[model samples]
Target: MTLPTPSTEIRPDLVLLAGRVRTGLGSAADAAETDGTGRETLPFDAVAVRGRHIVAVARRADVDGWNTSAAEIIDLGESTITAGFVDAHVHPLSGAESRHNALMLHDCETTTEVAERIAAFAAERGPEEWIRGFGLSFDMFVGHEITNEPFARAFGGRPGYLLLFDGHSIIASPRALERAGIDGTRDFGNNSSIEVYADGTPTGYLIESDAESLVTDLYPRMPVEARVTAVQNKLAEFAASGYTSLHQMNMEEGDLDVLRALEESGELPVRVRVSPLWRASDPWAETLRRMIALQGVSGRRWHVEGVKFMLDGSIDNGSAWLFEADTHGGGLEPYWTPSAQFTHAIHALAESGVPTATHAIGDKAVEFVLDAVQSLPSHAANTRHRIEHVETIPDALVPRFAELGVTASMQPIHAFAQRADGCDMWTTLLGRDSERAANGWRIADLDRSGAIVALGSDWPVEEFDGRKIFAANVTRHRHGSDRPAVDPHQALSPERTLRALTRNGWASIGHPGEGVVAPGARADLAVFADDPLSTDPDRFAESRVLLTVVDGQVAHRDSSLA
Candidate 1:
């Protein structure tokens, strides 16, 4: 039992966000008040801010008596204040750059629609400009070969490519292949491939990053000003969705410059902690040295914190490093040609005191990452690591996550791809009867096993809406859909899901208390129109985000709301 305490020394700041407060996850619910029916109710109703931290948290009546002569107080009535959300896994830099001026195709239901949209988009661009499209769904090519034939005519001899929802594959137009001189089969020495037919004719389907880079690398670079603005706009959307910090998963070229520029002019909408990517093709020593050099590099609201490694690609693209063959005998190869090299890099990063976030989607990929963790020397315990997209793993592996202290960073929004009958690309890849098929996601399993489970949107891969993710976590169903849940038993409680989106996000980064709303905690807060815990799951997904405060400053405020 505890009560609100206002600091006698700390004064009010530029703006005081006064409102109904939920201090933290069921924290200090003992404001010591009850209603006429004897049911307990929230006792606190205001949070005072001073500079970059909360100065005090008290009842609305008591807060009004504090020294507020210099503060601009914005009263938020009935708006529930909670810890701001943290998207533990995101690719903001690349997502923004790839989406800049690209054709949005995530909604096209059929191949014909995709082609028509591509054709229309291409007609507007100059003949010399390469065309780009993003988030093309796999359902469009369910029954057909993943070749560019159906869409080749749309390019009209222009070099163009459309990225799949998996972000691990791309269907390049015929002219794009010709422009890139991709005319024959080429072994990437791993799972990545040029993807050709028996006749050695390029099918214009590139798998994994290595192969996709052949054509995508030829894309014209956007100017620094344009890149800055694009990322700025993208991050604002994140803040508007109730996010106050992002654990960015990749650091590509020109990212640092854009971040610096955004911060130099003014505050960024959200705090960004970038984890630079380490590719399989990089030279071992040089790459490690360069990554270590960026350990503490930071600007106002952004910093380089960890290194991300892709142990395997997505199951949809037949690139996941599974324990055995998928339904089509694909999804059996690791992204790293010599798998031991990945272990070596992880060991080296641990020795250098830099944490790693490995993308492991299939059962085998998850196991291999755990094995690598087991082999780490005892001294490495000081360094924390996480496995992103623990999409599938056996029941036995569930307990191992907590035993090994690996945070299970997951994107619940990914479950939107699941279908009740199990014909979705992910489920189909793993046979309906396969034991591993029953192990997908398993976020609740990890949490129950005492593993720290962090939630995220994966941004461009899924919309960065925190509300939608919250609904997805509890309902195990697409918001507003009447379809039966994909794996209903694995759904987490609303209380647990809230922690995954808030405190666990900071815990995954070795910082726990920063996500809570306390006097000493960083002043990052989110105000929702409806109390998430009490609202219906479907309605909560569409709840209005009344305000978002980062560093004691309002990042987003719905003008319509008081």
Candidate 2:
């Protein structure tokens, strides 16, 4: 397909030539007209950017149509260029600090390894300060009992916390739990729990959001200056990986202030749209007022215009609010008590013109969120409320996503992390037989139902690598796991996956018309070493990001590109 020529000559700030630009073809039906390849092939080979907006997209030799001499021209040599990726869901400050400074336990496979890593971390810190780290997977203690005894010994009485890879669980040192004054006596309601032994003693493992907060709230956070630097570094890392925008989920007031400082200082490297977390316990009216006040803060590259709420917990941790109990007998735990409180929160957010992105994973939680949105007054139809991580849903509820204008914000890497193989934690949690697949992310099913799908890596929960997400979306398997494809039929095409990763990501974050490379659109482009549109999943790891442009400025460029 081709675009019409501009009526007058244009002067651009930058001109990229000889590139295979994957201009996002509109929707599923538009892609249907293609040769079943799941994308429309645009004929453009060059893009002209003029001060944060694309001025023209046309053939490589058509540079004369614009003021070529005024623009900084770069010959891409037939490289692949797409709209810079927009990660729809991320925890910027927490994930950034963890990635750079946290004592990593990502390589550990057993409790012994976890203990050794913690011990080493404590030794380096001299047992005086709190030890914070992440990246312990579920398989580490699949059949074995979970114990913090070794963790306590390693910490040598100093406080320490080791968060599971899922972020829904945490293992605390015994001293930390003691300092928190959390005996096995207090009830954490249904949504959160402090794991206890047979005789009613705390086990040091805290599950779900509330339980994890017990230890986390006491652990001193990084100073504001340090956190700001960490987030800045993380943004640089993201730009280097080709991300131009990030939808920061669950930002606290402090975090928002830090981000604002960065933006004001002209240090932010990418566009950030944030949703201040909505705490249910706060009075609804006050909560709305606070969010409204926060929403007023906006900048050229940073904005706060949405609210985030959690409805349920992770499925693998048995906190998912499923309609049916799993084979091991666990199901249905809403974060908000009485469930109506949760519904009320969503309705209020929508009515107030603030879009909401909820964390709901189970079929029941998904259905409940949809029902809440459905009950909104007719005029609230444009709410664009989203359901984050629609991991499990019945066939009947899939179409309602489009019918009600709810975006399905999903993480493709999650399905890859938890394959349908009998060995994964999800399979064991659900006890999936041959008739059922436990690792159903339903991307294809949702697409077939005409739903808008936005993709992201939950970040600290998983490695937030765009190529890994691409590899997972196309292969339906983990990056290095030897397991077979979970359900290969659910695998998406490269074009569709790219759209979800880029354009759909913007839509999910309440920013529309910003994900494509076209006239009047934001000049956010990602340059790759090869044509990912035609590449296989196996070769995705070989494709490198050569450059990333945000708002007509070079945010990240490989040294070789110079």
Candidate 1: segments with Cα more than 4 A from true spot: 1-7, 14-19, 27-33, 36-40, 480-482
lDDT of 1: 0.86
Error of 1 at 163 (Å): 0.6
Candidate 2 lDDT by residue in tens digits, 1-562: 4354357777888988755677775542122233356674446778888888888887776777678677898887768788998888888776776556678777677778888887887887755588887878777666666668767788888887888877888888888888888779467655788888999899888887778888888877778888888888888888877789888888754777777778877847788888888765566778878887777578778888788988888777778888877655776667767689878777776677878898988888899999999999887667778999988787789899989889999887787545444665667776657222443789988977888899888887887877777788888887787878867888889878888889888876556687887777889899888776777776774578888899898888888888
Residue range 148-248, candidate 1, lDDT tens digits? 98898888889989999989999998888988999998878889988888899999999999999999999888888989999999999888888999999
In Å, residue 456's CA in model 2 sits off its true spot by 0.1
Best by TM-score: 1
TM-score of 2: 0.93
User: Quick one: best lDDT, which candidate?
Assistant: 1
Q: Report clash pairs, candidate 2.
A: none
Q: Which stretches of candidate 2 lie over 4 Å from their true place?
A: 26-42, 419-421, 434-439, 510-512
